[model samples]
Target: SQKIEQNSEALNIQEGKTATLTCNYTNYSPAYLQWYRQDPGRGPVFLLLIRENEKEKRKERLKVTFDTTLKQSLFHITASQPADSATYLCALATFIQAGTALIFGKGTTLSVSS
Candidate 1:
């Protein structure tokens, strides 16, 4: 069995600052880790995905780092704005494990205030 953990608590950051979120897993070595953003009253929106083999991946102001040895992944949002505020989730693709077993974290809410 695999266990994925996130802050479960909300993160507070000011606008224009860099918001860093963490995801830690144990009892499993997933080939890849994925990040998503969920706004109130809506489904999660995919943000980024990093493979165990990848050191870091970036797109625009979003960046993700996967450390297989540490069994952790870091998600960053640069120049974060108030609009960026949302609950971020880390998930593992169950399909990669066996057939299809999507595992998700409890999610960390980010509050970016201007």
Candidate 2:
């Protein structure tokens, strides 16, 4: 079955360290890729978006890459802080005649500690 997969386990890291998260998909061609951060009790917030034709995207301390050939995307947080801890989700969007369809991974929880 076509699916998007992210690490189900939580990633633990110390403050000031870099945290890397992986998102892999099978049997899907997405036009745009997006990363989002969700807090414990809040909706997910948009982080970065990369086009299938683009290799990477960055903003502040966040970086994301899309490799259609490899069917994967990597999300990174540089100099991560405790406040940066959250559940990160990868979303794939494909434009359809109806409009746009979005598929999201289960998300990988990140825990940054002091």
Candidate 3:
């Protein structure tokens, strides 16, 4: 069955360390993969997107890796700070007849403290 899942436990880390998260999928081939960060009360904000043909994508302190064969993605955040703490979500972007949209995972929360 087509499915997407992320670690349910909240990730706690000390400020200045790197935070790593994982996203795994099965029974589906996505054309694109995207990562977003959501604040407590606000909606998710886009972080990065990777195409199926691309092995990885990066922007500043963020990095995303996609493996088509494994149907998985890994998201990373470097120089983690308290301000960077948030619920991170991974989505599979596919072109459905409905339109181009994102199917997001439940999300994984990261807490960074001194």
Candidate 4:
């Protein structure tokens, strides 16, 4: 069976520091991996997408690295601030009877203190 896991608890940190989050998985080979940010009572916005062959991907203050061998992904937010506080989700595309849909983990809530 396929499984994904992210930090279930909220991460509290001071502003201007880098916040690191982890995602792990098992029994699945995803064609690509995606990260999204979700605000309260809103849908998640796509952040970065890393392909199976890509080692790393970046956007602004965010950086993501994928290790297919270990089946893990790391997400980082640099110079974080209170505005950066949100729940980050990791998702992978899965093949199903009806084509494919993204399989998302519970996500990790990051609380950046000002």
For all predicted structures, in order, the TM-scores are 0.93, 0.91, 0.90, 0.94
Clashes of each: 1, 0, 0, 0
Which runs of model 2 end up more than 4 angstroms from their true locations?
Answer: 94-99
Clashing pairs in 2: none
Ten residues in sequence with the least summed lDDT for candidate 2: 93-102
Q: Against the unseen true structure, what C-alpha lDDT does each candidate score? A: 0.90, 0.89, 0.88, 0.92
Give the runs in model 3 whose Cα sits over 4 Å from its true position.
94-101
Question: Number of clashing pairs, model 3?
Answer: 0
Q: Which residue pairs clash within candidate 3?
A: none
* Candidates ranked, most accurate by lDDT first: 4, 1, 2, 3
Q: Which stretches of candidate 4 lie over 4 Å from their true place?
A: none
Candidate 3 residue 38 C-alpha distance from true site, Å: 0.3
Poorest stretch of ten by lDDT in candidate 4: 1-10
Better model by TM-score: candidate 2 vs candidate 3: 2
TM-score pick, better of 1 and 4? 4
Give the TM-score ranking, best first.
Answer: 4, 1, 2, 3
